[model samples]
Target: MIDAGSSGSRVHVYRFNYCKEEPQLEEEVLFHMIKPGLSSYKDDPVAAAHSLDDLMTRAVKMVPEELQYCTPIAVKATAGLRLLGKDLSDKILNQVRSHLTENYPFPISANDGIQIMEGSDEGVYAWITVNYLLGKLKPSQRGNSAAIFDLGGASTQIVFEPVFSTPSEKMSDGDHHYRLDYGKGDPYSLYQHSYLGFGLNEARKHIKERMVDQWMDDAIKTGRVYHPCLPANHNETISYTSKATTTTNSQPEPIDIQLIGTGAGATQCRAVIEKLFGKDRPCPTSPCAFDGVYQPPLTDTFKLRDLYVFSYFFDLTQPLGMPLEFSVAEFGALTSHVCDGTADDLLKHVPGAWTSLQSAPDTCLDLTYAYSLLKTGYDMAPERLVKTAQKIGGVETGWCLGASIAMLDGNQLCKA
Candidate 1:
């Protein structure tokens, strides 16, 4: 099967040497990753082709023993495809197809496997992961209302599913959380959706604009020339959060999610939140930690997702690309936030924990500037800033997970 992902294309030969008639496993083994591949295309089809050729060689080399002749290559493309124009996309697809069919003895087509899923695909994946993790926290009915936000490299997502009994009929992934990404891989089960446009960097930029916009409104309302938010009046940097599009889904029941997070950069976001909005209580009350998929009373009918599950990850398609290694384990750590020992806390637990500012110097300045502005202008309570950061961090992660969930929601997984 082909996995066209944000980074590149991955080919998987599922049933290598299995006998079609006997249905017996042979010496042939399954393929997971075909590396050195065309994972990202910045719209250069020629460049992409070069990467694909290198990756194909890598795949051919990875075949173990006698399986090389038996296994059929299921080629797929993912994130990098979106960058190409229609002409280029078609050209690339045709090129890949021809190359595979001409070269591989047991050649596979890209469209033969799962591709082109919907928003719900990812939503289902998010729901499944949420349920799995929540199961660790509590034993309850699987189907219940849960909201999600997912920040991804290519896009962002927000999803809301009301209370319902887990279907006796299950999806193909078998877990529940659906995968949303199309043109390549299968959907995962977990929580909800991944909003595409509003990830961390973009969201942060949006937040900065929003803060200025709000500052103008506040100044107009209060009628003060030296508006608290204005640099002319004050040099304080106010904190801001990435706001989201409101959900319209009715709340059938609270999912009471256990807060499962996936993807890298989540912990970094949590740190940013703590910096801007930690509680000022001298006497320690709650230990320094990130909040779970928290629920706040905002509207009457539907509410936001229970927790944040992802981070504002930069798109891998960019020239510089996403920072740090994005891994499931790293993401798993973010979602596993609790009052007890966690790496985020462990990293910054002691007196020097908060002092670890070596990662991003510019970010430190931004944080400081934002914090000063908010504190001086809005008279924002110290605790409120901490709370806001926690919420923002959660929301950012939640949106990403939500997007991933949507990608996996409506798969023909039962067939799997």
Candidate 2:
């Protein structure tokens, strides 16, 4: 299974034990990732398919030569492609389909094998992945299932079984409710929503735009701009195209803006990040999450229930010596430290911690944005405990596992 996500593309090769009463995933035999997702090749789609050459070669070697004929290879794109118009997305998918059909040893079932996945389906698969691994998928164990908070590059998703008493009909028309069977004992209903433009990278872009718009006049006068969310020592020259003043060319001209950070820490950064949540927007529904999105009230059950937050959430925390089980307040304190500390100070505290200096500049902004997204956007309690990790029980913690399971069940490849 190939997950063509916004930030990158990853392939998961699963080995299943079909001898069991119900098929079980014995292990994820091979997993590989390539950067700059298929969306990056919107203009040249053939290159998009070519980008997966290395990953496909690895996949071919993982599956036995004999079984390769029957094995299905599928690619499902997420938010990045969805944001691109349908025509462009289809071209990319078509190119991928062509590449797989001509070059790969694995079976290419049909064009549907490579397509864009809906945002709601992405949320559902992630929810299933977390619950299935935790042994919470059974009907009797539904109440024990943990909520999933996936923070991706282009979008964020929240999926859970709401314990609120509101009738399904009472939910706003926009709410997504799914009845998933997964070849299990019984089906269960899950409430899931994906918020576009709320992902870490998208939020950063929004912050940059807001800062530029707010400080443009002053920046033009003084040739310097201040962003509180950035690290104290952060300095960058960003170019933005300005509206044409005259009609002759009517083409926007690019202008370079200098951004310098004031030593303001998390307190100020939080203020900037919080605005992206659109908390002030009025909702037509009685209970709304944010930006008028419908959501069941977070009752006592929700407050007490466990949550598994992955993707960027795990990426940001794991390097900072955070435990697997930590409270939102503790996470906030950690972000505060990152916000206040300089890049050199951070390295001194945790020697050889950062994997890349390129990402070091955004640590403060990303951490602060994540904190606000949890506390202000999701209304999660500061003291509530949540699990954040890249993997659980030897399997990766993401939608691919659940998606592979769903594909096997749908194709009747997995036994009951």
Best by lDDT: 2
- The models' CA-based lDDT, in order, is 0.35, 0.80
TM-score of 1: 0.40
- For model 1, residues 89-134, the per-residue Cα lDDT tens digits are 6666666666666765543422342232344444454444444334
Candidate 2 per-residue lDDT over residues 47-120, each given as its tens digit:
99899998999998998887787778789999999889899999999999888998887876443578898888
> Where does model 2 exceed 4 Å of error?
19-21, 109-111, 165-173, 184-186, 220-223, 241-253, 342-351, 354-359, 412-416
Per model, how many backbone clashes are there?
101, 0
Cα lDDT over the full model 1: 0.35
Displacement of residue 269 (Cα, Å) in model 2 is: 0.9
- Looking at model 2, residue 113 earns an lDDT score of 73
TM-score list, all predictions? 0.40, 0.91
